[model samples]
Structure formats: C-alpha cells, structure tokens
Target: MMDPHDDVELSDLEDDAFIPSTSRAKSLKGKSPNRFLRWLPPRMRAFLENMSRIRLVIITVIVFILLLVFISYWNGRLKDVSIPKQSLALSKELARNLSNTAIPEYVLTYAPLVFLDSEDEFYPSDMAAHVSNAHPTMNFNPVKDAPEGLTLDNLNDLNDLGGDSIYLTSTTLLTNLPNYLHGQKPDKKTLQTENAVSCVIALANKEDGILDAFYIYFYTFNDGPRALGHQVGNHLGDWEHNMIRFKNGEPQAIWYSQHEYGAAFTYDAVNKIGKRPIGFSAKGSHANYAVSGAHDLHELDDEIPAHIVFDQTSQGPLWDPTLSAYYYTYSSTNNKFEPANDKTPVNYLYFEGQWGDQEYLDGVEGQEEFHGFHKWTSGPQGPIFKHLDRKDVCLPRDGGCIIKESL
Candidate 1:
C-alpha cells in the first residue's frame, strides 16, 4: 500500500509553506484621535470636527461690516455741519464801521498783553543761542540811531533795505522801533535791515453804546525760523497776533494763538502777580501755555499726559498789560482797518510770498528728521477774522476759540 494518510499530511504542509508570514500576522488598527481631541468625549470630538469652516469665514465678514459702518458715522459728522452765515456778515459790518475811531486809552491801559519775541534783537533765549552760534559775526540788533523817513506810507518797502519782513505794531509808528533794531550799524557782518514794524488799531464791539464786549488784535512779522529753536523750514515772513476781550471796558479774557488754536485765559484764571496774564511760549514749538509745562495739541489739556512743551527758562518774556493797544472793525472791501481816511500801508496782506529760505530737509545726525514741511515754511497768515459773538466760536470748525459758553 502507498500510505494515503501520509500523502494527505504532506499536501497540507506544502499549502502552509506557500502562504506569506505577513498574511498570518494580525491586521493593524486605524490611527487614534489627536492629543487635543483625546481630552474631549468621543461624541463631543466628533461634533467639533464636523463644524464647517465656512461659518468662521461668514462670522469674520459680518464683524468687518459692522466696523466699517461705525467708522462712516463718525466721518460724516465732520462734513454735515454748516457755518452760521449771519454771524459772518455781522462781524464784517462791525469791522468796517469802527475804522475811524482810535482804541480808547483807558481800554489799552487796562487790557492784558501777550508777549512775543521781537523780530529783531529781542529774541527768546533759545533763538538767541542759535543766532549767536550760527551767525556769530552778525549783530542781532544793529541800530543805535532810529532811521528817519520810516512811515506806514513807506513801511512796505522795509524789505528794500534788506529787512526780511515788517510788523504793523500800530497804524501810527512804534516809538520804540529803534530799540528793536540793530545797534547803530557798527559791524560789517551784522544782519542788515531797517526795522519798520508797524501796527493797526481795531476795536470789535457788539453795539455802539455801553459796549458788551470789544476785541483788540495785534500783528507782527518774522524774517526767519519764526519758531524758538533752530527748527528747519525757516521762512521770510511770519504774521502772528494776540487778541484781548473786554467786557464793560475791563479785560475779560486774553487769546494767545499757537499755530491756529490757543488758550483763552479768563481775567481771573491767569497769574495776576504781573498785573496781567502770564503766558509762556514753548522753547521751539512757540505754543503758548497758560503756565509753564502746560501745553496740548489744541492748547486744551482735555487729554491726559498732554504734550508738555518746555520753555528754555520758566521765566520768559513778561509784557506790560497797561501798554496801549486798540480795537478796530475790519473793512474787508478795502482791506483796511476802519477809519479809512487814516493812512493804511500797502496792503501787504495781498502779496503772498515765501517768508524765508526754502524748507530744510537735512537734519543733524542722530536727531529727529527736520523736513521742510513745518508751519514756518508756509509763512504766517496775519491776524485773520475771529468771532467774539459766541464762546464756542470756531473757524474752520476744528480750530480757533473753543471756550464753552457758561450756561
């Protein structure tokens, strides 16, 4: 016999050898949940994983739309408001009618004054330092003897004598003009100029009799840098003003502008130690602070941590309030101070020119960039019309007097 059972066992062994070892091994399971998802319940993990990413995108879009609408509402407010036209007309008429009269001596004797650096020799300390360092040979004040033939008639021609600009201190003449000029022309290197700074008188009043309020405005011009320190963009002409408000012939408030907006100090608010308001014009910025170190963007410290502009010395120019000043109605048609028969100088306001050398771009190394785009480069727009009609008077809306009316 061939042994059929043995042959059957042999056939089974051959079949097992032909099968791969991998096939005999157990099958591997799928990957487990990530570490983050492992902490959640299995059901919760599944729910989160099923969320549509599209929903996130939709929510983001909705939030952006809401933000856009919020911005639009605020921007619209700036454009919607209209200036009161009747007020403007009233102011113009008031300016023209008062042209003939002089600023009352009593009003000038009592009103407070806002002091500025004299265009010539009497510069603030910082400016004096710069002038001494930069132009050592040049005499800041060169006149000892007052030049004759200087008048409002020939005042506009002051620049013809090498003066960079003129200030109208009064419609008449400044008797003290000689004091502000160069010292007797003793030096050949001195800054050459005939100081012909003048002034115009105007009184803004609400009515003819028993005046409720009056305004006295002054004008000045600067030949260079215009600001305190050696800031660039020094210009040829700068016109600035200080306005005083009188109620019942008493000085009620003083307005000293820095750039466009300034502080309005009530008669009681300022330090009466000097018998007038004491204001400090910042060293370089020239923004007048009610007190030393009190400065802000609009000269209002409504925001905390205001921009504190420091003066070179806490003790600065102190002006005499009792000094004579005037008020005048403006005649817009003739560009004249009221009382047109009074000789008016050439309408220097009409000729707009660059007040100084071109704006400077190069700043000293390791210092803030002093580009030419400063206010000095624009030259000063002489005392423009400001309204005393409302305590909230604002010219160009964002600027000018912002004193809230006492209701």
Candidate 2:
C-alpha cells in the first residue's frame, strides 16, 4: 500500500540475504572450467575433468610423438617421388648443354663402358643432384654462414669456408636407404636419351700431345662387403674411375680404380666393345676392373692374405657413361678444371672435401667395431684428391706405376 519502488527494493535485498556466500561460491566452482567440454559426451567430459595434471601431460606427449612419427614417414615418401624428377631434370640439362662444347670426339669413342653387377642395387649417381640433396658441414655441425642453397656451380665456395674439413652431408639418413641413394638405374632404351645417367670426364693434356682422360663415376652409397659376419667399410658416397692414356690420338694404356689402389694395363690388353673398353663394376663396391671374377685386394698389399678381402665382378647390365657426361680439361700447372661448356659447373671439381658422412664412433647408434674393424668408415674424398694432376698414370703415392700385361 506504500510506494511500489520501495517494496520491490526490499524484496530483492531479502532474496540475496537468503543465499549464503559459501553456497554461491560452491555453485560457481561446480560449473565446467572449459566451455568447449560441453560438446563432449558426459562420460568423456567427466573422465577428463577427473584426470590429474601429470596424467594429462603424459597423454599430450604421447599424442605429439605419434604425430611426429606420422609426419616423418610421409616426408620420406615425398622425397622418394621428388628426388628422381630432380635428377632427371639435371641429367637432361647437362646433356643439352653438352652440345655447345667442343669435346674431343676421341674422348667419347674410347670412354669405358661400365658393367654393373646383375644383383647390384646401387647405380651411377648425378653430381648436381648429389650437391642439391646435401648440406655443407664441419665436424658433424652445420657450417656457419654457409651458402643458403648449395649447388655444383658454387660448391667451391665451401673450400674457402671449411676447406678440407667440409663434408657434403646427406639430408636423408644413410640407414634409411632412400631412393636417391640407389642412384640412376641404366635403361637400355634411355641410354642415349636425355634420361641417361651422367658421368664426369676430366682431360689432362700432358707433354708432347699426350692426353690422360679420366672417367669418374659417382654412387650415392657404397655397400661394404661382409667380413667375419659383420659389414665393414660401408660409406655414404663412392667415386670409382678409369684413366686412359693416349698418345697422338691413339690409346696407349688404361687404368682401373679398385679401393685405394688400381690396376693399369695396355689398351690392347683389355676387352673392348668396338673401340670402347669394357669395365666390370664390383657387385656392391663398384671397383672397376678390366675382367670379371674375384679380384684379390691383397694384390695391392702383400701384407693382407690373398682372397681374404676380394671384390666380385661379373658382366651384367652395360652402362655407357659417354651418353650423358660432363667434359672438362684439367690443367696440372694451375690445378684448375676448365669445363667444355660455359654452362658446365666446375666449382665442384675444386672442392677439397669429403663427399659423405664422417666415420661414426663405436658407441654411436647402429655403429660398432669388431676385432679392430669398423662396420662403417669415412667416405672417400672428391675426385680432386684422386691425383688428377699427376704426371704418371698411377697415383703419386703408388711409387711406381705398374702396367699389368693382362687382367
């Protein structure tokens, strides 16, 4: 019967005083902390709400680990598809540009036709593709201020940055056996086509119209032979070669690289497919030889027992390296490589570094040493260290160049 506004205010105050402060606080705490949980099922929401902080963190970490594993698996698959295309493109470009150069006709005519073993998995690799897939490193650590995207054209830049200590470390783990590591398989139909694998030909003009032609072959992975039930001497990169000594445009002698040492023979002594010499690449090691059979490594060093360490070779698929190759003239005087085509990359030739990963320690994962022998060893240095400018047919370290009369 009094003022209506006064009556309403008195009723609101009475209602608030009826509820205790503790009871109101308890009601607020009972509500879901996260509004998103409202969309979840009742049982699931309750379980998550009751989970301890430590349990929640452990579950989160497991989920994150699973996600990372899924991403890595797919990433390797993507590389398998992309690497081949990249290699093919580089092969085609090198072949196309080769036409512009004035490479001697005899160089191609006498080039060694390599025979890869029938059971061999690894094949000839492309240098440009190799450089593209690797990064410069020093002592297993990334080189500081190194080139962002290293390529064959600028490979020599690393010589200044890290010099002999630099390593062109592969991006993919060597243990993974990536497709690129298998390299370019020779196709009979594609041997003469743009799809052919590329090789390196470095010519050294000697005194009195003498020409020493070096045919270098690259492989992404070197499969070491099993010794005493353990794989020993395995490495990430391989460089095998053959050097032909010619006088007055005629072949005189040929040399085949095998491990640290190689064999040399008169040009007429080796088997020939027409004017081209035939070389057999060892089953897995890719050591070039003039004939097929078991090649005794002890022949180079008398200290090792004969047949204890040997390479097996056979006549398998023929690989014509001349079909696709990079030609260059090496000047021993200045120790420089001059590419036939201006577009050909020569910087890589000057690189004085290892082409693969350094040797792993015994305690490192997947690496071991048995009876003073390591399962894995350091990769071979680039062709530059192969005595490219040597005056004799054999490497300078060989003391005297032994020219074998037969295989």
Candidate 3:
C-alpha cells in the first residue's frame, strides 16, 4: 500500500524516456510537413516528398506541349491573304466622254477563234449578266450607298463614288461551283443570235497606220491549280484576251495573254481557221495560249525550268467570238472609248473598280492556306486597266514583245 504513488511516478518516467527527441521530430516534419501526407505510410510520404522537387519542371513540359498544340490548330485554320495592288497608271494622254465609231472590217476579219478546254467548268460569260448577279462592295463590306439596281449600263457611276476600293462581290457565296457561275457555253445557235453578248473587242489605232484589236473574253470563275491535294490561286471573274496587231488592214502580229505575261507571234506563225487565228484557252485559267499543250505558268523564258505549275490546253470547243461580241475603239491619244454600235455597253469599260470579289482574309470561313500558298487570290483588274492603250504589241512593262516564230 505504501508503494502505490512510487509505481505511478516510475510508469510516467518510462513513457517520457520512450518519446522521440525534438530534433528527430523536426526532421520528420521537414520530410512531410503536409497534414495529408502525414496520413500516408512512411514510405509513400517519402516518395511524395522527393517528387515535389521536380514538380515545376513536369508542369513546365506539360504547358509547352499544350502551347505547341494551340499554335498548330490556328495554323491550319487560317490563310495568308494577298490583295492585288492597284493597276498601273494610264498613259499621259487623256480625254473625256463617250462617242460612237465604226467597227473596223479588219477587226472581224482577223478576230481570234477561242478553243475552250473540254474539262473546264467555267465558260465565256456575259458582262451584263455578271453585273445582275453581283452587288458593289468596298473592302469586302457592302457599300450601303451603292445603287440598288446595278448593271453594265450604270457601272460607270461607281467611279464617281470612291471607286478606288470598290468590288463587285457575287450576290451568292462561291461554293460548290454554282451552275450560274459556270457561265454560258456558246453554241452555233447562241452565236448566231443577235442579242447574245459573250465576248468584246477593243480597237486602238497606233502610229504608222497600225491597228491593235484586243479580243477580250470573260469567265465567271477561275479554278486554281491543286498542289499536294490542296487548291491554290483560285478567284472569281476571269478576263483573258488575245490582241492582233494589223498594219494597213493586214494582220501582222498576234499576242496571247497567258497569266501575267503574254507572247507575240508573226501573223503567219499561228494556226488559223480561214482568215482567223486560233487561240487555245488554258483549262480553268482561261489563259490564251498560241498552242495546245502543257504551258508552264511559272516559266518566264526558255532558260528557266517549268517544273512547278502548268496550264493544260487542247482543241476542245471551238468558239468564234466575232459572230457575237461587243466592239469598241479605245483612243489612247484622248483616252476616250468609242462604241462600234449604240447597243454596246460602254459604261462598264469606264468602271475603275474590280469586276469580282476581293481576296478573302485569313481565318475566314471556307478559305485557307497551306505552306504559305493561299487557296484564293485577288480578282484580276478589268480590261480597261490591262494597258488597253499600250503602244507596243506586249504591255510596256513586259520589256517589249518578243515575237516568236514558233511555240
């Protein structure tokens, strides 16, 4: 009975002796101080503590991968847009107002017979019809003040209302290659019809009794070439031309518009049907070439290799433009356009705006680019800006026309 208190004191001292030292407890706390980790086994807690040292690096790598994925997604969705620069300035000689003139007999006599590619989806289109299907736009936005009922007859009015950035955007979005956009395919019956208007001729009188007759053809759409299974350089409203220079009513040289450049040939060198020369319109591009074959669109001269893009042409549909076309005489000296007949639509010739939709911007729906190449390019300038009053057989910027004797 006397030793009960002493037993209790001894038990208390023994418990105190078994307790961990303060330094050891501090070491354990440093390893895994988190309350959540304390509930885990010693081995697991140690493992988790060790992993914490490199956690920032692991998080950094994950973030970098996500950034890469983000960049790739936008790259595939967007495209680079190219807006064609304004056309070169007109010649110094200038004048005003419209007039009437006679269509020279030589113009019809030496007019070109165009050969459309059999595989081409688009064909020669009527200017008035195109106007009826489109509305005027500025910088890809609708021009609120533009005329509601725009047509070839009133197209020139746009020049008075800030025409610099104006564009005739299609009323319907160009998708799936619509039938109306394919345009009218000329036939013997349609060609014979007096009201039919599919092509146009602009005559310019040069020095020494030389006459330049430009046969301009229009197409509603221009399909681009496919590269690596992707389409590039597509656009709306194509305008191609073949110019025949005459010396005293005799055909002397012929120029075929191919892409940005053209070639001139002696009158006798080109293939002809009766008194008219034959021009093969390249597939989809509608570029006029003197011969029917694979034309390298990228090659500027014989010295260069044309291993990239090509325009294919063949003897397909034969179209005699002379049978149904509008005729006009462009006077460079006075910068005036004189229509051959009152029925000809001369107002459109004075229009300074683009004839088709402008280039679509990147990230726009249904438009994209691959490897720096755009799926769609800017619409080409109208014939009035194609150096219609050019003095040389080729455009002045072409560095003088190289008249080839053969293709």
Q: 376-401 in candidate 2: lDDT tens per residue? A: 77777887787887777777663688
lDDT per residue (tens digit) for residues 117-146 in model 1: 322233321111111111101022222332
Model 2 local distance difference test score: 0.77
Task: For residues 221-321, write the lDDT of model 3, one tens digit per residue.
Answer: 88876655777778878888999999989998999997777888999998776677888888888888887776775575453335666787876766766
Candidate 1: misplaced stretches above 4 Å? Answer: 1-101, 114-201, 207-233, 273-275, 284-286, 294-313, 321-329, 332-335, 339-346, 349-376, 384-396, 399-401, 404-407
Range of the 10 consecutive residues with the lowest summed lDDT in candidate 2: 75-84
**Which scores higher on TM-score, 1 or 2?**
2
Query: After TM-score superposition, what is the CA distance of residue 271 in candidate 2 from its true location, in Å?
Result: 0.4
Error of 1 at 229 (Å): 11
TM-score on alpha carbons, each prediction = 0.43, 0.73, 0.72
Poorest lDDT segment (10 consecutive residues) of candidate 1? 129-138
Clashing residue pairs in all predictions, respectively, total 32, 0, 0
